[model samples]
Structure formats: structure tokens, C-alpha cells
Target: MTTTLIFTQLTIREAQRRKILWVGLLMGLVFLALFAVGFHYIVAEMDKYASLEEALTITGVLLTAGLYAVDLLVILMAVLISVAAVSGEIESHTVDVLVTKPIHRWQIILGKWLGFAILLTLYILFLAGGLMLIVY
Candidate 1:
């Protein structure tokens, strides 16, 4: 619905403006750094003694591991993001404006849900893509 879409966009905008978004991203970045280091060490060790096939096998395994790590990170980020969505807006008095608007209650809930769902999906896809690139 248009109402849902508007709220979704509003939620996205609010999320982007907050400092916690960056802090959450910072943690994800740190995780990526550690993943890169671990991956580098693993591949280095493989290159030292592994044959082409063996190295490739190890690479596949590590790639899957990286994906799993990204999965965990994205889920954690989702938790952090969603846990505060409604509560955050209400606490900050931003919802006062929305309350005065012609928006339906279900629209607000659906929009927030859609917003976070999209956000987490994109975040997971992005991290998964990055890890796959590294692995490949």
C-alpha cells in the first residue's frame, strides 16, 4: 500500500540518519576484517602445501564458512536494528507526527517490517557477495 511504502521509506531514512546504524556497520566491518585475515591465513597455508585440487577444496570449505559468518552477522544486525525500530521512534517523540497523520496502525507496522526485511536482505546479500568474491 502507499501508506506502507511511505512508512517504509520513512523508516529507512530514520535508520540511515541515526548513529547506531554506523556503529552496527562498524561491528560488521570489524567482522569482515577478521574474516579476511582468517581466510588469508587459510589460503596461505593451503598454497604452502596443498595441491591445486586440495587448495580448491579448502577454498570451498572456507567460502562456506565465510557465508555462515556473514549469516550470523546479518542476523545480529537485524536484531539490533529491529529491536529499536518502534521503540526508538516513540521514545524520541518522532512518532508524535505520525500519530497525527492519516496513517493506519497496520500500515505503520507493515512498513517497519518491510523496511527491516529489505534492509537485512540487502545487507546479507552484500556481505555474501563480498565473501564469495574473496573466496573465488
Candidate 2:
């Protein structure tokens, strides 16, 4: 296999070993659950006095609010993961082993980026899908 692919796999494995993926998934699920419960209650109460048009408008607003919160969480996760990915390795001197390898420096950076990008994409998709399902 290519060096970049190897590094990508290594990065993903490290994240798994650290349980970051599991923690993120658990947190996302909890957020979705809470959002779902709150949305159900609010819509039920709104239904009592609100017209159809008002209900639809309020639903849209609630969905948008949920989306905005998800967006912020995703952004925060991406920033935290990316910031720690390289710096932590360097601080722990793990970069020495990597540098001593035959792989080019750019390959390591690109591989780490690809790994984190894949993770973040999956996370975003999961959270967004959950929100959409709950709202619709």
C-alpha cells in the first residue's frame, strides 16, 4: 500500500484506540434524543393555538435552529480534532518515528487530513440525518 494510505489508516486506528469516535457518536445521539423530545413537546403545545400556517412556520424555525446548532458542533469538533491531531503527536515525540520513515512529509500531513475529513463527514451526515428525520 502507499504511504499516504498507510498513514490514513494509522490515524483512524489511533482515534479508535482513543475512543474519540465512540464518544462523539454517543454525544451526537444524546443531542438528537434531547432535540427530538423537546421538538415533540413544543409542537404539541403549539398545535393547540397556532394555525396551520403558523405551525409550519414555527416548524421551519425550529428545524433551522437545530441545524444551526449542529453546524456549530461540527465546526467545533473539526477544529478540536484537527488542532490536536498533529500537535499532540509532535508533543509526544511520535512524529520522530514518522519522520524517520521513508515517507515524504507531505504524505503524512495529507493522510492525517484525509482521515479526519472522513470522520467529520460521517459525523456531519449522521447528525444532519437525525435532525431531518426528527423534524420531518
Candidate 3:
């Protein structure tokens, strides 16, 4: 296979092997659970506050903030996953084998970056979908 393809596969495999991905997934789930509980409480309290319209307005704002928070978390995870992708390989001496091949250093770097970017995009999409389902 081409160097770029190899590098991309390696980067993705590395990210999958890391515990951080699982941790991030767990955190996202926890956040969703908390949001659900909070939403229910807000709805209950809204009955006491005044009109359902006003309560809905408040809920909408909170839900928007929650979505933004999820986006931020996904971004953070992307950066962490990408940053570690290269550094971890170097530390583990895996890069040595790849570099010894016919591949250029720049190709390796770019390939890994692309892989991480893809992973990040997938993560954000999933998180957004989950949030939308919860909000609706």
C-alpha cells in the first residue's frame, strides 16, 4: 500500500486503541443523561413559574447551550486525539519503522492529520445527532 494510506490506517488504529476515545464517549453519554434530568426538572419547575411558553423559551436557551457544549467537547477530543497520534507513535518507536520505508516524512504527517480529522468529524456528527434526539 501507499505510504499515505498506511499512515492513515495507523493513525486511525492508534486512536481506536487509546482509552481516551472510550473515556470521551462515556463523558458524552453522561452529559446527555445530566441534560435529560435537568430538562425534566426545568419542565416541572416551569409549571410553577408561570406560562408554558416562558418555560419553553428557557428550555430552548439551555438546550442550545448544551449543544454548544457538546461541540466544544468534540473539538477538544479531536485535538487531543490528533496531538497524541504522532507523539505517541514517536514515543513508541513505531514511527521509526514507517520512516525507514519509502515514505516521505511529510506524507506521514499529512496522512495522520487527515485520519484524525476524519475521526473528529465522525465524533462530532455522532454527538450532534445524539443531542438533537434528546432535545426533540
Quote the positional error of residue 84 for candidate 2 in Å.
2.2
Q: Select the stronger candidate by lDDT from 1 and 2.
A: 2
Best by lDDT: 2
State the displacement of the C-alpha of residue 99, model 1, in Å, after optimal TM-score superposition: 4.4
Between candidates 2 and 3, name the one with more favorable TM-score.
2
* Best-performing candidate as measured by TM-score: 2
The C-alpha lDDT values of all candidates are 0.83, 0.88, 0.81
Q: How do the residues 1-136 of candidate 3 rate in per-residue lDDT, one tens digit apiece? A: 3777877887888789988888888888888888888877877788897587887788789879988989888877977676766777789998899888777899998888878888887887777887777777
Per-residue alpha-carbon lDDT of candidate 1 for residues 38-76, written as tens digits (9 for 90 to 100): 888988888889999998888888888887888888877
Candidate 1 residue 133 Cα shift, in angstroms, is 1.0
The ten-residue window of minimal lDDT in model 3 covers: 79-88
- lDDT (C-alpha) at residue 19 in model 2: 60
Task: State every prediction's TM-score relative to the real structure.
Answer: 0.84, 0.90, 0.83
For candidate 1, the per-residue lDDT at 3 reads: 92
lDDT of 2 at 71: 92
Candidate 2 wrongly placed segments (more than 4 Å): none
lDDT of 2 by residue, 61-111 (tens): 999999998898788777766777888989999999989978789999999
Ranking of models by lDDT: 2, 1, 3
TM-score of 2: 0.90
